[model samples]
Target: MTDLDDPGLLDDVHPRAVLAELFARQVRADPRAVAVQHAGKELTRGELDDWSDTIAADLQAVGVRPGHLVGLAVERGPVAIVAVLGLIKAGAGYLALDPDLPRRRQRALISAAAPVALIVQDHLDRLPTHHLPTVWADEAGLGDAARPEAPPPDDDGSRVFHVVSTSGTTGSPRAVRIGYGAVLNRLRWMWTDHPFPTGAAVLIHKSYGLVASPWEMLGGLLQGIRSVSLRRDELLDPVLLTDAVLDRRVTHLYLTPQLITGLLDELDGRTSAAPDIALVTSGADTLPVDLVHRFRRRLPGATLLNLYGATETASNTAAFDTARLAEDAVTVPVGRPVAGAELSVRDRHLRPVPIGVRGEVCVAGPPLALGYLGDAPDSAERFVRMPDGSVLHRTGDVGRWSADRQLEIIGRLDNQVKVRGYRVVLEDVEAAIAEAPNVTAAGVHAAPPAGDTVLIACVAGTKDLEIAALRAYLRERLPDYMVPSRVHRVAALPANSAGKLDRTRLADLAADAERPVAARTLTPRGPLQSALATCWEELLGRGPAEAEEDFLDAGGHSVLVVRLIGRLEKATGVDLPLREVLENPTFGGIATALQRRAAR
Candidate 1:
């Protein structure tokens, strides 16, 4: 068994120091170090400190006080970073609101968080118009005025540092209140266990609304390391992101599995020199073993670490370094509990299960977040008091200790769905599909209720995959009931703003594919129609597709549409508008639009 009771490791974490204090210490240590870089601009530690201090003073002057919640709806950049620091220095916790999310959802989150004031980027029109007192972050501290002399508010590490919302995949998003003590412990453990070089840079490209974003944005700054911030559009473009990492000399990266997979694909077969990345941490979703192998092969010099935890646990409780994984390793273990954290697998009754027995993964210790904000019942239910006086947060994730004592996550307890009459674990099916030839990633979801709920599988691969062969491959391993009844090919699985797999969107797509649509017997007439039909058939894995068939009904999603558009543009040399193609999704509509443009 692996022993995690290390007194030295526990003693390293400063119990009283909060994030604000730690950042202040870094500023004092090296004021000239570059703290944040975004788009061609950079902010030195001293500049960031003064700007945030001035903003903090401005916030304090407008009735913002310690323990107050302030809403931050700013685009990703230096301004957002400064706003976060400013709020922390003012002794107020921030509620991050992503500018890309729907205005209704943003308003809903703001209402739920009930922040006293809002900090927004004035140029972003997507931000909702809130009635709260507003502070324009972009213009707050841009002037060369004198820095404030007032010191930051005192913090004992018990105050709420931030309030972030859950992914809301299963239901409405829950606001989680994370205290400074929890975040401080997590940061301390990360710095101690995986310390980066002095001038190393980290990327902060994740949506600010996510619970995981703060670690990316603040982790490097607190240690006096440069953090490169990318806009959402830049983050979506793999080539641009790779260029940024290589150009900015990013040595460390914390990304979701989905995002990392895309980056690895972009980096594959490149002749350019690989970036000097020292560490790449994967979290926010399950890290696939295939991805681990790919990372080992593609960038053998860098170490890949799989971190496991949730929003309630301040992002990660345990981490596994995939440095010396065996060639035949099937699943990646989430590793032992980090310093200042205790992890145990428990049964339904919350009793500790025997080693190697699959059960719910429960976390205890200082790294655990306070609880869900504004929901006392949920807080009490998830954050249960143990008989030993330690508060244990039940992670709904199902996992077990391996023979070597590392935690191996099986799947979510809630992911067990009823297919026909038999119960099926989606992750199990996804694993089998992912092992198939050419397949890189896979997602399995059960279709919504009808007469009978059927299982659907979505697979993304380097090459085209045959559904019949995939089903046959699954039949050899999975049981009859476990085999997915329907399969869809996608360029990549969809991810939410948080970078986690959007399972809700996947299920909706699967359900839409299952819905029968009337097929019109329309054949290709012109060159445009012929090209459109060919591309559609190739993308959807159905040849000789009718022009009148709805693209979405034939298992075509936005990702696939983008690929289809690329193929059509290459084939005909006519510039096609993405919005036009999406608005008129049918092959006939697209072909007509293309013909009209060509005629002009």
Candidate 2:
């Protein structure tokens, strides 16, 4: 076994560094620089330091100590950033919770984290059922007596920095404990390789509770770069995102491939290129070749990078520059390992596979997370010690090493599914659905045959169970994507002799149970409506559509909406606003609107 302290190998920098310590260094160096901006609120480094210190003091008073996990429930804003930094300053790890997530899910995640205290932006009256002490963001008279301190007294890198919840093997969410040192290492890597200019403004539009949020919000603090938080609604609008980037002169921006595609489509009809951006990093899913090319064309001045990694590994293990892709390259390579990281493709036997052979993708690095918080068995199984004593994290993704040594991700080795860029385990959705009233057993899967990835859920329940009610139940407890496009009442879900779920049979049953569209009672009144209805029918793969049937309920999602709108624009030579398309989604409403537009 290779010795860890071998003199020949260079020692890692920031070895004993804590995440808060790194950010504190920047605050001391430039106190007057803007540290964060959100809505109309801006906080300078000195101000942010003071604010975080006060919150930390409040946390300290509430028994929040070193290594404690604090649940943070707040909207995406300057206050949210303050809460996160304050948790770090208090030497406590934070579990970020999206205020908008279903109360049940929030409660479940919070219960799993078992935080000593829960912090929120304003009122905590609406918070889910939890027994933890609640700390309000506006703790006015509590800690204002003392002057703002710098960082905390503690500088232990071994303490857990944050607990990130990801799709678990079971139905519940698995919390991953990441050390302060691991988070610091990732920031150090970004600063060294993809250096952002000191004090440059960076747009942080990613949602809370996601792994990427920390990288965007805190990573910038290490280099004195301003972290600008965009509200959830602002992040959803393409035009707003473009404007935000340009208005802030954002030097660094991160997006998923889906967002990138939406932004590209928004920019397509524009007369000029978007304002110059320094770096645009994309991840969370495979970057499509077409989207890469479009991004290059739309933002020629920006360096577009495809980052590949997982929640267990903090951030990126490998990065691919779209500019390096060969003209004939069919798949965009994930590129070589990042600094202080190693990539190995190993077969089922755990032996290294040939360079060109497909196998499980494994990563080893200093930035590797501590492990799954409460899942020791899973942690041991996924993180294995090699014969040489080095640890390797088996990322269940299947990929192969290219001729040029780049990693190409091909597929998943398990039941994990990604919908519109969010990673989800199928069992998690099934578990959520099974909790519904009267649902005896539930099976959920992402069906690709619907022309798009539409979630189809089948449940064995009483004959009187309503599909719409079941959908509403899921919607209240899960994200929209996790909700089924259609809920089919199955007599009983088939299982194999070994007692495992027979997914093949479940899928077949789901396919056979889909509802066919009924014949239209009302004929098209005009060519505009007639043509649009025909297009909708073809896109929905249904017969004549009902006038009031919800478009999304009819198996359409945001992705399909884009394609449908694009087709409508091409067919009718009329530029339509996305708001109109969404608002008048039904055939009768859309048809009438189109006819009116033609009249104009």
Candidate 3:
């Protein structure tokens, strides 16, 4: 065992062993600094560290021992991160669970995790009592736990600490164990390189609030800075996200394109002063070049950075500084690996491919996680041993190195997509679509649903895809991406009873872009509102759709609809359209302003 107190230990090189040791020192230095803020609440470093200690002590009291399996429901905010740190402090590795999970599905995960003690908020009595022990993480419970005495620490980075659930492409979620050695390796790399400068704090976008950023959670822990944790769903809601940023005066933050789109659209109404934020990071999904340009145009002072990583590799293994975005967007590489991590392009044979050659992404570092748990034996084969006998988790994502030795994400080698930054499987979208009302059967494709970041589906009639409505149905069971972006209703889908789509035919449908079916939603009209809405709905190919509360915010592509006048004439029976919809927009004063054209 290693004691955390050895001087200059972390300065030279440290491992997961060093992470646990830094706990007290970090607290001592920044005890009063704000650690997290959510729903009008704030937690400080001393408070979180103290709470983590208690959580660790409490779990130990409940028969949780070193290496015991503990199931942690991954939720947004301070409590979630504290719970995970508590597991490590208790000498147990934790399994992450998403709170929004359906009961039966959650039950299956609980069964698989077989956690000795589960940490969860009792807010929803939704999770049924399990055969295994349970600990409700309410206010009273937290207050009663004891503070953890720091463990005798070491610099050994190889200790196991967590089991992350990753559903690659589609299947049951596999738990990937991330060891201490790996965690330390990753945190060291991040802190040593792209730190937010000492004393600078960062806000978690809350989309990934469940998992701490190497910079936000651990990096803050190790480096004596603050990671302002915002509530997850609340952040998704624009007003709340903006308020959180301003109120907290966040200096650094990370978000995806979907989020940036919303934030940028909503920023004007929220506050005149942009929060103190300087660095805005994005990744884990495609960063649209247009959106990147929009941010620079709007917030000329803000720095946008793109970070890339996966569960297999610790969060933020590589980052592309957004400053590079002004020059060239698409060609921007994922950039140099953090401090000690190594990223490479490997060929099918698992051999390192030459720079600029496309290959499988392989990452090796102290922060890399162990292989997936309880998986098919063959899955283990993907773990390749390097010449020095080190292990690298194979990220099936395809990428290439630039002439400058930077890694660039090409796309997924599998059939998965991240919508709004959440990884979604196309098959899952199909299954959910199959469950839609009046939907006898369906097939989903990554086909740009009417050019929006949505799944495309062909339903059973001339019935156009009621996207907003269908989304409501899918939201009941599946995550957002599983809902098809557009549902096409054809009397008969070209499929065999053995049931497989004639993808060739579907591609043809997408090509003609004939999805004129409108989504079902509260209608907007007047000449300008109605005409603009009609063109948008048609060009995008589906909607009985209610226009967005904010037009520009809903994702309008000016280039995609150059024929705005013709399309509007075809749908709304009126037109005075200019170069684009932006020319005139609103129900109060547009064409139909005189006669109230009812919502269809």
Candidate 4:
């Protein structure tokens, strides 16, 4: 308790300090500096400030005031940055509506946020229709009028700065409210510890819908460093992303482990020198030691850090530098708490556990977010008030402190499932599978409780690794109840937009794997049927059980469905609409529809 209150634990930034004020100082210091770069255009600090001030005036005219929440549905560009700065200048927090997500999901988030107004990028159709007053980012008349002279709204650090939607893989999404002070603390700590050099640039490639986007886009800007924005299509192509990093002189890059692996693979194939990045940070998922070693080999000069936090913690609380890690280290510790933050491993009773004992990882500090926006019960449960008047966030993650004070994360408490009356940790099973020869990655899921429940696993490995051999390897290392009953081999595991493992998609694949083998041996009837079936098998990593076997039942999700449709159209030389594939979700149904369309 005393450690929690220690003055040294606080960040150097004043509690009353806000990002808007800090950014203004940077603008005044160097107005001619490039503030943001996108596509082939650049915006200087003075120009950006003027543009945002115009937007702020427009928002204020519409009755937007301090503490109001505004919806920003803009794509990644200079205009998007202007919208964010304008929202803060107007003293209104922003809720970014990702244009790539489904319209329904965007609508759901807007409903939860209940924002007073919406700022949109022209021609963006991914958002649902709303009655809120709209301001177009790409409007021809924008910034045409003279800039208003009204002073910027005052912020004491208690006002909400933004709202981030939780992943909601297991349930409905919840909006997490973050304050100006919380994020300012996070950015200040990064600036102090990993100082950005002059002429340095940060690649703002992550989706604005994610919690990490704010820091990725603004952390460098507040320090007068340039931010380079990448379009979604460019981000998906490894070569394009690598080229952008090199061409833009990006000094700081942050990505999840999955995306990092892709970038490393691309670098391995290149004859050119690796990009001269100063710092590379990995977060949003576990950083595998193998990946860390690959980064070390690929970018020897750059510092590699593993950051650990959640949407509720302003994106980062602890960081570990893998530069000096030993060769034989099995796991990477998340390292000590960042400035202005404190970490504790506590038991179910909210009592702190001794070092080296696993418990729920709780974070307490100024970086902690306000809480869930609309869900009071959930906010109360996850954000607990300690007897000392300090608020701590229960991360639901299992972790322990090492003898040297490093934090080692175990697995999630919710991932614990009962199998054959014995409790088992899914991550432990995945780790055992990953240890198998040539197995690159693994994901495990537990089937719904029935008369006899079972465990399923999906592994991505070399062709030499057979399912029989993998099962035997698991049996040797894990208990009988812990051994997965069914295993599926794939080219690679799927990842979400944020570059983290898509657990829900993995569970869908596992469910498909759980079906009996005899039922999955259907024969294609014609060339059209065979081509469609081939595409389905390739995408799902398994064949259909019957002609009527549903595509979704065969582990196909929304993201996979799009890929499937694209492949089908290419292979068959026929135009297939997305709705046609979704409406006819069965192998027989889609094949018949495609044949008819081809004949017509």
Estimate the TM-score of every prediction.
0.74, 0.85, 0.76, 0.73
Q: Write the per-residue lDDT of candidate 2 for residues 1-600, one digit (tens) a residue.
A: 121123332134323234555566777888888888888677788777777778877788788887788988876767777788788767788886777667777777887778899888666456787687877776363335343334444455457777777776565667787777777667667766777754467888766677767778777865677887887545766666766776777778888786777667777767575665788888887777877887877788789999888888877889898999876778888888884778899999888999899999998977687788775557887999888988889999999998889899999899887776778888888988887888889887677752346678889987668776787677688766666776778889989899978988888887877753344555666667666767776776663446776667666665566566667777887656667878877776776667667777
Q: For model 1, how big is the CA root-mean-square deviation?
A: 11.3
lDDT by residue (449-554, candidate 1, tens digit) is 3223556788888766776577657654444456665677777887899996799898776656544422334577878877877787666545434666556545
Error of 1 at 341 (Å): 1.4
Mind giving the per-residue lDDT tens digits that candidate 4 earns over 304-393? 998888888878899999996779999998998995788999999989999999999999988899888786455887899989999999
Report the C-alpha displacement of residue 452, candidate 2, in angstroms: 5.9
**What is the descending lDDT order?**
4, 2, 1, 3
Model 1 shows how many backbone clashes?
0
281 in model 4: Cα distance from truth in Å? 0.7
Top candidate on lDDT is: 4
* Cα deviation of 253, candidate 1, in Å: 1.3
**Per-prediction backbone clash count:** 0, 0, 25, 0
Task: Output the number of the TM-score-best candidate.
Answer: 2
Off by over 4 Å in 2: 1-18, 139-156, 449-452, 491-499, 515-600
Residue 141, model 3: lDDT of: 51
**After superposition on all CA atoms, how large is the RMSD of candidate 3?**
8.0
How high is the CA lDDT of each candidate model? 0.73, 0.74, 0.62, 0.75
